[model samples]
Target: MGDGIVVGLGPVEVEAYIDFACPFCRQFELMAGPTLDRLLEDQLITFVRHPMDFLDAVSTTGYSTRAAAAAAAASDAGMFHEYARTLFANQPPEGGPGLTDGQLVQLGQEIGITGEQFPETVRRGTYLPWPPFVTQRAIGRGIGGTPSVFVDGVAIPARPGPILTAVQAAIDGAV
Candidate 1:
């Protein structure tokens, strides 16, 4: 219900908990995108992305929440995947001032998410409150870190092989 993206239509669901400021999450996202995209195209699974903001302190400018909120805005605009990938590709180093609200809006535009509403949403932190709730939910589920992925409620490694294998297993078992 918060700032997450849900795609795909296969028999199983993959829930990915991630933090924008985490490099490991970025790496996993990049590695997993193509495989997931293929599955989505085939309607073989449902991918749910849960964005977290545990690394807010790492960025001098509070980029974690900002980015998460921007993502929610993108989701509303139907551009979650593109916006998220762009953010990961342009991820700023931790401990530095992350991208500004303006930059986030610009990125959205670059990815075809337009209108004043998107930028205004990013600027206003509309979805800022969502990440903590998401983090709490993850913690309640015994997940302590980013890049946590689940297939049919079973924890799977962030690596491509394990994730794909688990998803395939879920698909095969369903059929």
Candidate 2:
């Protein structure tokens, strides 16, 4: 049960454990997305995003699980990156009801992930178990929080600056 949504085929492997409902994870994404994109473009690192649901209980509607499942649907449609960014950009506050299934579908549509499969997947909760599974696996691996980052199998601070620095060091070391 490999749960990572992998992007890129670079030499160094960078894994990010995140929860959709986590504000800090959102911040990390906003801060590091571009740099990660550039690194992917340059084939410096293989980015793997492990979408977890540890924060599902924080939201009134289990937003973390729902959103992560929706992201899996987006990944099926080959639009995971866009859908994730949109979700983060429109993140609802904790303790509130997260976006409805309809809104998730709409977001996917807005990102050009059309067709019935995506919406149907969300509505049917097809990947509902995925987030929790990944969350548990992360916990089993000693990852205790969201936005945990690893560069070349070495844990690094989830902050943008440290992530960038660690990724750069990994790239350099590979040379």
Best candidate (score: lDDT): 2
Off-target runs (Cα >4 Å) in candidate 1 are none
Model 1 steric clash pairs? 10-44, 10-45
Cα distance off (Å), candidate 2, residue 137: 0.3
- Least lDDT summed over 10 consecutive residues: which range in candidate 2? 166-175
Candidate 2, superposed: residue stretches over 4 Å from native: none
Q: Which lDDT tens digits does candidate 2 get at residues 91-164?
A: 88877889999999998998899889999999999999999899888998999998999988889887768767
Candidate 1, residue 159: the lDDT equals: 83
| Model 1, span 1-80: residue lDDT tens | 74357876677888899988999999998899898888888888888989888898788877888888889889889898
lDDT of each: 0.86, 0.88
Clashes of 2: 0
Error of 2 at 113 (Å): 0.3
